[model samples]
Target: MKQRPAVDLSELPTFGHGPRTPTWWGTLAFMALEGMGFAIAAGSYLYLAYLTPQRPLSAPTPNHWPGTIVTLLLLASLVPNHILKRHAEACEMLPVRIGLVVMSLLGIAPLVVRWFEFPALNIYWDTNAYGSMLWVMLGLHTAHLITDVGDTLVLTALMFTRHANSGRRFADVGDNVFYWDFVVVTWIPIYLLIYWMPRLD
Candidate 1:
């Protein structure tokens, strides 16, 4: 038999280096699209508000207490999520597990509260222009949150299985966290518009 050369694992790159870490370009592109969506929605709301002189049909308007609490929960998730990304980059398992658990809890809590709020508010999609805008905006954001939770879960599993020890894992975690951050940050303006602005006017 002819002798064959042995392959050395050390010779291979620890991680593929072509725009590592979730591809910044891809993340930016997605963010751009999301931003445009939010902008258009906000514009529509403002246009409708301007046309409607009545401004909030009833007094003692919808209480924003629930939304505020949800917002706080979502905002709090950012810290642990960021820490998880950092720990992943350092190839530390403990912090990554802790961070993932925290992030998942943070992401899921707001969604549950949101579901509860919908019924208590006793509003419909066509209740008024405000209702329509509120549903669409919150619905869109909620969709993003659902996706984020799924992504985080996948990452968590990878970490648990020791499949994320590759150099690329850091990039993956970083990328997911970046998108998750965008999802939360984007909600701030929408929250202000939907919950606070109505009360002020």
Candidate 2:
């Protein structure tokens, strides 16, 4: 019996970055499901607003400041987020470490600003359909923010330890950046809906 020569497999890298990694695809699929959720919620809000006599149902237009501030912060964070991703891709320990620490803090800043944002709404979630939808949308985004920030914090902590040496860790950092971009980008529409919709004729 002639057995074929077995191919040597040792030359291949154990892991990869971006699409080469399973985690990246999983993150993408997760984002698709989440994006659908956001779309449905946003659609429902529009339907309710269209059916109502008054768009906000007598609630004053929400103060745009807090949400606006959060928006600005999220937008601003992109700079450092990409920087982190870049360093992570290169597996550069120092900048990746610095970026993660900075990201951890940047992540918290919005959550903190978001606290003020809910109050700025000037309407309780239970108040009416508009209020409920607004809160639901905002809450959805807040949940994402919290999730990503927590993940980033954990990764940041891990990056400081001996465990940071692996390419897998840097790949995780890159994925965190990808998810953070989603979180930040999703907020723009939510922001417009929450803050600007009430004022529209």
Candidate 3:
């Protein structure tokens, strides 16, 4: 058997921030698939609207207030989200922990607002296809929001433990930040679709 040339493995980093690591790519892949789901859902809504232009067979235009509040809150979340991202990238444990706590709270605030959003829709899931689509879109985004919040809370707890010093955990925080941005960005269009689309008619 021929021997391969010697190579040093000691300097290889076990964790990296941002897209340099596998987890970041995995996070991106997840976001891409979820984004596709949103695209398809939005397309279906538009198609239904197109078919019923004269009277969109849907409920009356929903109250835009709650959705508007949630959108503003989501947009506001970006500030802390990016701050957390910066701390995570720098592998700074103190700021990272603080950011995690802030993020956890941020996650919960929108969820609270989300409860009001369903009622603001002024439609029930079983009412008709329009109602069903509306609920489906909201439910899908809420599921993602809940999931990310849960993840953030868990990570926050873990950061308080002895494992806080791990570089991998910082990378995990970075990934969480990345995912939350996706969660927030995806909501903008859905909010418009659910609340504003009916007004255009």
Q: Number of clashing residue pairs in every model?
A: 1, 0, 0
TM-score of each: 0.85, 0.97, 0.95
Over 1-201, each residue of candidate 2 has an lDDT whose tens digit, in order, gives: 998889899999877789999999999999999999999999999899889966678888899999999999999999999988889888899999999999999999999999999989999999988889989999999999999999999998998899998879999999999999999999999999988878775
What is the descending lDDT order?
Answer: 2, 3, 1
The deviation in Å at residue 197 for candidate 2 is 1.5
Model 1, span 20-65: residue lDDT tens: 5338668878889988999898988888889877766443355677
Across 19-79, the per-residue lDDT of candidate 3 in tens digits comes to: 7999999999999999999999999998988888764474678899988888888899899
Q: Ten residues in a row with the worst lDDT in model 2? A: 49-58
**Residue pairs in clash, model 1:** 21-171
Model 3 segments more than 4 A misplaced? 1-4, 55-58
lDDT against the true structure, per candidate, is 0.77, 0.93, 0.90
Q: What CA root-mean-square deviation does each model show from the true structure?
A: 4.8, 1.0, 1.6
Candidate scoring better on lDDT of 2 and 3: 2
